[model samples]
Structures are given as structure tokens and as C-alpha cells.
Target: MSRHIDLAVIGAGPAGARAALEAAHRGLSVTLLDEQPKPGGQVWRAKSAAILDAPPTPETEAGNRLRQSVQDSRVTHLGEARVWQIERAEDGWKLHVLRDGRSSPLRARALVIATGAREFVQPVPGWSTPGVLGLAGATALFKQDLALPGQRTIVSGTGPLVFFVAAEIRRLGGAVAAVITPNSRGDWLRVLPGMLQRPDLLARGVSWVADLMLAGVPIHWRHAVSAVDGGSAVEAVSFRKLGADWTPTGEARRMSADSLCLGNGLIPTVEAAQLAGVELEHCPELGGWVPRHGEDGTTGVPGLFLCGDGAGIRGAAAAEIHGRLAGLSAAQHLGADTRAERARLHPGYVRAARFGMAMTALSTPRAGLAQLTTEDTIVCRCESLTRAAIAAEIAGGANSTNAVKSGLRAGMGACGGKFCQTAVARMIAKAEGRAESDVPPPTARPPLRPVPVAALAGDFDYFDLPIPRPAPL
Candidate 1:
């Protein structure tokens, strides 16, 4: 019996459905949460309403107006729920959540966290085959199971999601076979004079490179995909030539493809903002260790905020202007907006926080991509470990990510590591000069709802109550 709120949010994505539709249109009551039963998280993901009544695709019409602003009435949504931790209580933040198999407790005053951003995948060498995948898990299996893990895909990566997964695999007709991009068209012509000072983001990056060059595909650029042949599923890949500190070079071509779609970009899912302690800040141009926020997404935890791409990898129109400046700084921190309506919403939130700091300094990543791993690759695919056992636990001294998860437990399996804990905490903070927020992150317990220990021992409530009858005896 917990469930209370003023604004809980968590994530329904598209920055918690536009910060729960601008804090329930400024009246605030919200609740939102989501493990996704729908409400576009993985970049506008809903589907099934016969694919949401098919038709619209200005990216599913802003995720169908953020799922009709979470069906209004001061929002509640909850979808599949999940949450997991967030604590602070005495009268404000509890959270916990999880769903269906129960385990509740909510209560809020303002928490937002529009928890979003995943997909970085760096292990390589036939990346756990079975049709590879993860340009956002093949665009969330072509947006919610219309499914198309094959039929000759390739779509390697760098950013702007490999040209939006090769324009959603050419709008589902499939057969991409190229789009490689290890980011060097001379680093996109040196970020095109800072992307031509945003002529509408350089005309939507020149209309997504003119719809992947009129869907004839084949873009390659300094290429990448180093090795991914195939035995059981993905058919071929290999490529090379990246050099100038992005690595990969000399002779390797291959390319056949039956699904590869890699990724090397997104990061900030900051596990519920580092389980509510907030304050992180590596900012390798905003993708690793994010949440230090401000300019109205207010972090350093004071009624907790953080918006879009978990407050980093800024995309989706700067996550809808950082979800309208975290719903007008949480409606001016609950006095219900009016410092002249947040000074007339401060110049469109400082022009979407300076166009999300120039697209996070022109899509950062690419620092020799941690020497694209080798030493029999596989860095913690759920503790299978190797990359020479995380460089022999950073050459033993285990320097932070809780001392390399106590020397190579490497984020102790079962994805509590959340896909190899930020590339094993940025390769142990670049081999221990130390400071990816001095490492820490990796402990978010609770069945924050996975349940099914045989459905919690067949719904046992200490063998189904009724013991009070002994008092009557």
C-alpha cells in the first residue's frame, strides 16, 4: 500500500514521455514508470495495435504523440513497471517498484530521471553470433517484433544510429548490406564546420545523408566491422581501414551479411542515476558517466531530475528539449511554475541547452575505441570475462569499478553489470589514471522484479496465513 506521487516518471522514454507530458500539463501528479509494455522507449517503440494502426512514420508520429500523452488525467501509465531502487524517504522518494509478480512502494515529490540510453556493444569477433544485432537491438526488432534480424543486413555503426539503422532497413523492405561507417569522411568533414551552425541540424544531417544515398545503400566511409563471419546465423562481415587513432587498418574486406547491425555510440542509462546518489560526470562528450546536469535538468540530487538520453547522448530533438526543461524545472520545483512561468520558459530552455551542447561535441566516442578488444575478445558476456580477463584485472590493482568488480568478477554476471558495466568502467578509467567518477557503480539489488522463484514459492505467504486461528483456540 504505497503508490503516492507528484511526479515519479522513471522512463516511458522519449524522455519519459516528454517528462510525463510536461508534468501532467503542469498540474503534476504523474507516475509513468515503464519496462515497456509500450510508450516508445527504444527510440519510439510501441507497435502492436496492428503496428499502431500502421501509416504514420515521422518516426511513428512522435511516438504517437507520446502515446497520447500517456492517456492524460494527470498520467499514471506504469506499463510493465520495474524501477528497482531509488531511496530517500521520510516523506518523499521511495520507489522500489517491479510489477505483476509484485513488490511495490512508490511515493515521490519529484524524481523524473527519464532513464534512457543503452546500446554500446563493444566486444567484437562474431559478437555472440546468432545474427549479431544491437544497432539498438536491430531497432528494437524493427520496432516491436515486426522482426527482421536477417535478409542481408549489415548496418555497422558510429553514430546517428547508423543512419537510423539504414533508414529502418529501408522501411522494412530490408536488404541493407552496407552502411559501415567507422566515422571518417574525415570525421564527417571535420564535423562540417560545426555542422554548419545548425541549419536545422544541417537539414537533418542532409536528410539522413539523402536517405542513405537514395537507398542504394553502400556508405562504408573509413569502414569498421572487423570480423564477424558467421556459422549459425550472421553470414559475413570483416571490413577494416579506420586508422588515425580509430584503429583497424590494412587489408581485410569480406562483407556478405545476413544481419550484423552493430553499435558504438549510446551510454548514459546511469542505473536510475547511479541508484539516486546522482552526481556523475565523465562526459567523454556526454555518453559515458553523465548526470552532472543543470541548465534545468537539475541533478546533484535535489528532488532529482535528469532528462533524456538519461541526461546525455542527446538526440530526438534533444530529447524533446530535455523534456521541456525537465517539465519546467519540475514546475519550478512544485510551486507550480511562475517565475513568470519560468521566465517564459527561458528561451526554449536555452535553445535546447545550446543544441545539446553541439550534439554532445559532435558525437564523441572514437578514442581508438578501447583498442577494439582482442585477447580472445568477450569482455564479460555475463562473466565469461576475457579480454585477457579484463586486462588481467587492469594488471592487478583492479583500480575502480569497485576495484574492477573485485578483480575480474567483472560486474558479476546476470546483467547487474548492465552489459559489461560501461565497457568495464571505461577500461578501468583508462587504465587507472582514475576518474570515470572514480569508478563505483555496480550494485542495484532487489528482485526489482524478475520474480518467478517458482512464482515466489507458489505464492507462499508463510504457507498462506490463517495462523491467527490459533489465538481463538
Candidate 2:
């Protein structure tokens, strides 16, 4: 008696939300499933009604519009449903879902994966401590729950997210000890001329950095956090200077702070796609191994598409455009739209995707990251693999992440390899003298979120609902 949907979008982030709303508007029945309790993915993580009712900030208002648009009767919002797998059935695909200690299945004519991405953490000394958190985690605590992790916080790492986190912390009336960025001001200068092609975006980026400077938040360029010092929680951090190649020069210094927020970058959550048999490729510029997606979000599998960070790490704007293109493509495949409609949407999608590609290429992880690790540093907290162990594995002819993982069991942890995979891949790549993109990532399986077997057994009919059939001809 499982319910059937015309389109089942397996994420409620910007991409999935846009796809669901667009598909529903085009006279298709849509079901939106998200692991979280609300619609907004990590980027827009706020309470559903709470966000809608709040006096609109410019940021909140845009989300408000999108939220209101997706509230139509044709859309069924299934919050808290964790999809374990997507298997190709005789007709379309079957999605096995687990919800609240129960299991159920649903069939959909088409599927759009917008599972999004997660923050990439490079293991450093004391990274696993209680007070130490990822940049995104800190943002989530402040934005969603209006809670601060500590009174004083040091946000470190590279990329635009570091600045965003610092702004949020300062906005929340928390003391920002410093914004430590590994990228030098010269790095920004090198990318600035190219960024000038989009004056508006350049202006916005400059304004963000300028605001931080005006607020007296010390911006440390060419510096990286080497270690976090604390017993049960983070109390201070050690930083080292990077040379021209981005390697730490032997010089180091320390700063006292209550919390250490670190993030190297983000990687696409491709578990669902991989489980569905989607082909993956290692694109260092776009995180690690991401699914090979076409320009219009179509995967090699028919009726299956990827959009947003799940496809690769593009910002929210690009994710939205990709979602719309995927929805249009799905509609065309379903005979819901004409050829002309598809043709019209194609050009806009291309332009946005090109912009995303350029941004991704320029901001890709630098080579200097490998120099951050020390022999005593833990590589995998879950498996207790030390840097020495990984180095030994690489020296012993393990050239890829899988081989290194099998040799040292670095990624076989409770978190399902999320934390250790990137670091392991990078280490293997460096040892073998291969491009980071040459190292294949581990196979992604399900259940996407770890569920206790007890919970699965208790709720056998969790995903069960009456199936809806079309009217007879």
C-alpha cells in the first residue's frame, strides 16, 4: 500500500524545494522528503513557520517567497524521512525510506537528488574535542537555534564560508577573537581581476571582507591553524605561516580562544546517487569524487537527475537554477512539456552553470593542505588511525583511498567515513605523486544516515501509505 508519486525529490534544500514547486506547478504530483524536520537545507536552515513569520531580513524574505510557493496541495512534504536506497523497479524506481523507527517504500516516475553537501574537516590535533566544531556547525547553532557555542570564537579555514561564519558570530553579539584564513591577501588579488567580470558579485565579496576589517576582526592571511589545545574542549589554537606553495614554514604561534571553528571546504553528499549506481568521477576542483552529471543536471541513468551541491559545490543561486533546469528536463521526459519549453530553458541553465564552473575552478583546494599534518596527529578518530599509519599504508603501495582505507581502516567509523575520506584521499594522492583527482573515493552505500537496527525493526510500516493510481482511460 505504499504511496506513489510522479516526482519524488529526495531533498528539501534549495534545489529539491525548487524542483518540487516547479514540478507541482506543472501539474505533476510531487513528494518532497528531507531528513530534517523542516524544508530549508543547511544553507537555509531555519524553523519553517518561524522563518515565515519573522520580520523579513533581505535574506529571510527570499526564502519566505520560495516557502510560500511550495505550499500547494499537489506537493506532499515528508519531513524527517530518511531515504535509505533507490532501486530501479519494473516501473520507474522504488525508494526505500525509514521514518521514526519504521520502514516503508514509495515509487516515483522520476527522482531528483538534492541531498546537498557536508563540511570537509581535515583532522588536526584536538579537532575532535567537545568545544571544537566545524564552521557550518557553528553557523547552524547560531542561525537555527539562536544559540552560541561560546562567548569567544575563532573561525578558521579558507573560502567564502569563513567570512560568512565570522559575520554571523559577530552579528550574534559574540566576541570573534579572529578570522584566520589560510589564503593570503595576494591570493585574493590574483583572483580579483577575473572576478571583475561580474561587478556585482565582486562588490559583494569586497563588502563582506571590508566589513570584517572595519569591525576590527583581525584577518590573518597566509596562516593555518596547526593544533587546537584543550582538555575536554578547545581553549586555544596554534597557527603556522604558509609559504608560497601554501606549506607551513616551521614558524608557529598560538592564540587563546574558547572555541575553534574549522572547515577546509565542503563535499557533495553523493551516497544516495552512488547507491543508485550513478557513475562518479574525481574532480578535485569540485570536492572529491562527485557524480558525473550532464550540463542540464541529467545523470547517465534515465529519469534520475542531480542538482545543487549533490551534483557539486555551487552556491545557493546556482543550485536554484540547476534545480529549475532539472525540473524542466523531467517535465519534458514525462511528456508534460513540449520541445520548445525545453529549448527555452536550456540557455539560461548553461550560463549559470558556466559561472559555477569558473568559481569552482578558482576556489579549489590548494596543494599546501598536505603539509598541515604531523606524525602525532590523528587521521581517523573513529579508527584511531594516526598520520604515521596512513603514511605507512601509502608507502606500502596503497595508491587510492580505497586501498589506503583497507590497509589502515581509516574511514571505517560510525560517521560512515565522512570525516576521514577527504584527508585519506589527499594523503594517498600526495604519496603516490598523483593528482588528488586521480584518487577514487570510497563507495557510498546506505542507509544514508545510520539507523539502529532496533528502530528499523520496530517500524516495519513506516513508509507505507495507500498507493495512488491514475484514472483508467
Candidate 3:
């Protein structure tokens, strides 16, 4: 039997949570689903540890309020629920979900996808080492568990996250060996107009930088991580100055470290949106590929809307407003008048989006990032496929991401294509002498994520299964 809902929001992040609250307040039956045990998503994830007694920052305060509201709301919250497949039904959408190792079906008359975003880490030598993790992953450690990556960690990457993580480590009594980035000071200068749109966010970024400087952390601009050294765990990190095109220019300098926190920036997590039949377009400014939708989160598909970072790369501030607009639009689609609600949210959404986009553009990885990987560097960690191996497939007529996958099984790992698709597509574009956009991402398939066969088996028996008759001979 399928559980039916008036509105079903995927992802209980800032966007999805807000959307659910809005719809429920409007008298719609709503359900909010997420893989995490809480509703704040990554930006506002609920802290798990109580021993640290970490001081409250603006982010934590806002996140706490959001989570509290959701907890007090009438919307049904389903944590640890994973949607394996989604497709259209007679009146709306049907979702095949796996929860507590059991498969169930849910049908929603309206849907809002606020799946959010993931970090982009361009491959570098020794990046797969044990002590190396992305900036976002490092933040999550301290944010949730009050844990540190190591005593002395080297934070290397682009975007504001690099600085934020460095400061976080210092606050946690961990040593930051150094901070390195490929973006130059001029790159940030060029995006100042957008950053000015949100003075509060800009000030927050400045505070992070100030804290890093006060801690005597050396900030290296126009530089990129060349390699992480140590046989099994990170012992040191090497970096070199970058040219105008972001290519390595100066001699490589080494820094002693116990671990490396690296990230290029963020890319929208569009798998759910794509599976929901939402159209996507590559926008470098908004963080790689994002769903195409109106300001109100209305997409070409009726009753199926998109919001938050999943729709684009806007930060949590914009995501909250975007969620409200999406919820209002979704309600309107269900025949409720939401003009006043939509009108109130549109301005804040636009302004926050402007600032977030500026930061995203400044942090976007450059083409030269592809050169960081040597021929033998591992690009696909699960398959253990090296850069040279993937290039060989491309040289042999593997034109698209799917074609390369078909040849080398690059995306056949447990991760699906989340980690390596962008890098693989970059390799294809470089080898084919074409733009990266020319190489579309691999086609999305059902069971969006891997699931146990037994969980999907449900209440069925082989003995009772209908058997097909043999063909006439």
C-alpha cells in the first residue's frame, strides 16, 4: 500500500524544512524526509556532541531556531529515510523509499526537491590518503562531533570555506599549518559587487579571516596544493604559486602537517532533481550544473519544484527564503492564493542569491585544476582507476561520461558518480579538445542510490511468483 500526501519535500535541510512548514501551515498534508537524523541539513546540521560547549555563532543560532520550529511543527518528519526511486503517478509522483531496511511507497500530490549541494575536490597527488578530507567533511566533524582532523592540519582549497575551516581548527585548539588557495586576491576583488549585497555575510567572512590572522596562520593566495605526502596518512602538503590562468607557476614549497583539508568549492547535488524530471543547465557562476527553474522554484514540471542549493549554489540564508517561495508556489499550484507570501520573500531571495553567487564564482575551480593530477594519480577511488587509465578510455572513443563509464566502469562504484563524474568529464573535454559543457553528465537512473536487494524484496515469495511460459519452438 502507498502512503499518500498533499506535499512531500525531499531533504530536510533549510529549504526542505521551511517548505514543509509553509505547506503544513497552509493546511496541506506534508512530509519531510532526509537521510540525517535531524532537519537542519549540512549548513545548519544539529550538533551531536555536548562536551565541547562550543560558543554559539550566528550560524548555530539560526540553525537552532530552524530545527526547533520544525520539531514543533505539524509536518511529519522521517529521518533515516532514503528514496531509492521516484517516478510520475496518475495524480503526482511516487517515491520508493527504504527505511529501517524495509521498502515502502509514498505518493505526493506535490513535490519540492531541496537536495542541497556537495563539495568539489579536484584530484591531486596523494589525495586519497587516510588523513586527507574535503573542507566540508572537516567542518562536519567539528560541527557535529566536536572532533578535529588532526593536531596540525593543512587547509588547502578555494572559496570562503578554506578560511572558515582554518579558523574553526584554531578555535578547537588544533594547529593550522597553513592555508593555501588557487584564487588570487584579484579574483575576490572582481566579485566584490555581489558580496556587498549581503553585508552581514560579508562581515562574517571577514571575521573568519580575522580569526585566522590573529592565530598567526599563514594565508597563501594564488597558490594550489600540488601533493599530499606520507605513505598511508598525510604527513605534509606541497603547494606552488599559480599563474593568471590558475596553472602552477613557481617552485613547489613544502609545509609540515599531519592532515590535509581540501576542497575546490561546491556543486549542486542534482541527482534527485534530475530523477524528478527537472531540467538542468551548466552555470559556472551558480556552481557547475543546476536545475532550471523560476525564482519561485517553479520548474517545467508541474507540481514538481526545486529550491535551496540543489536549485543553485546560494548559501543557507538564501536557501531559507528560496524554500518559502517554493512552498508558496507549490501551494499556488495546488490552487491556493499565495501572492502575498511570494511577494514578501522575493526581495530577500534575490539579494542573498547575488552574494552567494559571487562567492561561488570566486571559488569555482579553474581549468588548470585538471593539471594537478599526474598520469598515475587515482581519480576514481572506488574503482581504483588512475588518471592515465581514464584518459586511455577517452583516447579510444569514449566521448561522453556514459561512454567512458561503459568502457572502464569508472562510475560503477558504490558512490555512483558523485565523486568522479566531474573529473572524468573534465578529462574527456581536455582529450577531445572541447568545452566541458559539451560533455554532459551521465544519465541518471533509478535506485538513485544503491540499496540492499532484500530490502527491496518486500513481502514476496519466489514460490508464488508468476512464471513466464516458454516461447513456441
Candidate 4:
């Protein structure tokens, strides 16, 4: 038996939650799916029982409100369900969902994808060490298991996340050995136009700055992490004065720490969109390749919609607006009048988007970041493929991402290239002597995620699966 829904939403993040609420209110049978066991996505990740419950931050407050709405609106919340394949169907879509090692087919009249985003890390030497963690990864450990990465940690990277990560470590009584960022105080001035308009963000920034200063936590701006030290675990971190060219200039400084928490920025998650044949373009301002979408989250596909960071790299607030718009648009498609609701969200969307553009301007990763990879630096976490190996492939006429993957097997890992494709694509661009945007990301294949053989044994047959035709743009 196939489960049928009027609307099938992928992801339980701010976007998908709001989308589900919107459609459900319009009297649609909605099923909201997420791979996580809980409702909140990354931004509002639900904590485990062992951890001391955190008081609701603004993010959690808003997230809980929307999540509560979804729960009360008769929307089906499918937690711990992963959709690995989506094929064209007679009605709308046939989604292959895997849960607890069993695969089932779901038929949906409409689809909403809000897969969210992940941290973008610079590949530096020794990052493969056990204690090294991405900024978001560290947050997940703290939130999910109430676990700390190390007793002593160094938080380094760009973007506002560096500030938050450092504060969290300090709050946990973990020694924040140092905080480093490539952007300097002067860089803040460069994006003043955008920051000035966002007074709410400004006030919060002031509070965080004061608290960190009062706690005696040293913040080293205009500095970038040059390397991570120690054999099996992070023992030290090396830094150099930030330069326009990303060269290790002046005296290199070292800080001792058991763990390195680092992330420069975030990249949108668009695997689901790409697998559905939605068009994507590389936009550095929006944190690399994002699905081409409209204000209402309309994509190239007629019945499929996109929202949140998966569509662009906007923050939580902006994502909320996008989600609502998408939900309302979806409702309108179902023959419900949503004129007033769309009107209400449009202004907030515009206002937040201005701030978002400024954020992009202020926190854009420097081009010099591409040079962070050295011969020994690991590019693919799954295969342990080295920069040298990828470069060797690129030099040998592997000018495209697919070519490099074919030769070096960098993206043929458990991650399916999500963890490494950006860096690998950049390496290809550098080797091919072309622009980063020119080297396109590798194509995505079905089994978008790993699946169990038992899950597909009697319920599904790959050979019987029909090819999905692209929807009209």
C-alpha cells in the first residue's frame, strides 16, 4: 500500500515546519518528513534528555511555535524518515522513503523541500585529527549529547558563528584557548551599510561582544587558522596574519588546545532539489550553488517547491519568511485564496533579504581561501583522498568535477560528495585555470543516500523504476 498525501514536505527545519503548517491550515493532508528523530532542524536542534534543557532562545521560541502549529494542524510528522529517491508519478511524485531499514513508496500531490544548510570548512593540514570539529559539529555534540569536544578548545573561522561557538564553549566551562577570524574590526566597517539597518542584530552583537570581553576571552580578528597540530588528536593550532592573498605572512603564532572548532561559512543543501531536476547556479554570495527559485519558493518544477537555506544561504529569520510564502503559494495552488497572507509576508521578506545581502557582502569567504589546501591536506573525508591526489587528477585533464571524481574517487564515498564537492570543485577550477563558477558540481545519482539491501529486497526494484522526466521550467 502506498501512503498518499496532498503535500509531502522534506525537512523539519524552520522552512518545512512553516510550510507544513501553512498547507495543513488550508485543509490538506500533509506529511512532514525529516531524517532527525525530532522536529527542530539544525538551527533549532532539539536537545537530548541527558543534557540540561536550554531555555528557549529567539530561534527556539519561533521554531517551537511553528512546530507546535504543525503538530496541532493534523499534519503527519514523519521523523527518522529519509527519502532517497523521488520519481515522476501519474499524480505528482513517488518518493522512496527509508525508515528503520525498510523502504516504502509515498505518493504526494505536492512537495516542499527545505533541506537546510551545512557548515563550510577550510581544508587545512591536520584537520583530520580526532579532536577537530566544525563549528556546527561542536554545537551538535553539545546540543545532542551534552558532550564537549575537548576540555580546551580553540574556536577559529569567519562569519558570526565564530562568536557564538566561542561563547558556548566558555559557557560550558570549557577553556576557549583563543578565538580567531579572518575578518578584522575594519572589515565590519566595510559591511556597515547592511549592519546598520539590522538594529536587532546590532544590539545582540553588542551584548555578545561585551560578554566575551568581560569574560576575558580574547578575540583575534584578521587572523586565519593556518594549520592544526598533533598526530591523532588536535594538540595545537597555528595562525597567521590575514592577507588579501591568503599567504602565511609575518610571524606565525601557535595556540595550544586539545580541540579545534572551525568553520568559515555555510553552504546550502540542494541534493533533493538537484535529484528532482531543478536548475542550480553557483552564487558565491548565497554560499555557493543554490537551486534557482522565486520569491514564493517556486522552482523549475511546477508542483515542486523550494524554501529556506536549501534555496539560498539566508539566515533563520529570512528562512521563516520564505517558508511561509512557500506554504501560502502551495495553498493557493490548491485553490485557496492566499492574497492577504502573501502580502503580509512580502515586506518582512524584503527587509530580511536586505540584511541577508549585507551579510553576504560582509562575510563572503575570501578567494584566497581556495589556497588553503596543500598537497597533504585531506579533501574527501570519506576516502581520505588528499589534495595532491585530486590535483594529480585535475592536472591529468580532469578539468571538471566529474572527471576528477572519476579518476580520484574523491566523491564516491559514503557522503556522496556533500562533504567534499565544494573544495574539490575549487581544486578543479584552480587546476583547469578557469573560474570557480566554471567548474560545475558533479551530477547527483539516485540512492542519493546509502540504503540497506534488505530495505529494497521485496518492496522495491531498481530495474523496474522508471526514469524521472524533468518538469517544465
Top lDDT prediction, candidate number:
3
- For model 1, residues 17-70, the per-residue Cα lDDT tens digits are 777777788787877888888787888887766565656666678787778767
TM-score, structure 4 vs. true: 0.93
Model 3, position 119, has a per-residue lDDT of 85
**Predicted model with the maximum TM-score:** 3
Q: What is the lDDT of residue 63 in candidate 3?
A: 79
lDDT of each: 0.73, 0.78, 0.88, 0.82
Tens digits of per-residue lDDT for model 3, 159-192: 8899889988888899999899888888888989
Evaluated at residue 431, the lDDT of candidate 2 is 77
Give the candidate order by descending lDDT. Answer: 3, 4, 2, 1
| lDDT score at residue 144, model 4, on the 0-100 scale | 63
lDDT score, candidate 1, position 284: 71
Listed in order, each prediction's TM-score against the native is 0.34, 0.90, 0.96, 0.93
- Candidate 4: residue pairs that collide: none
Model 2 spans with C-alpha error above 4 angstroms: 48-56, 193-201, 354-363, 458-473
Clashes of each: 1, 2, 0, 0
> Runs in model 3 with CA error above 4 Å?
49-53, 460-473
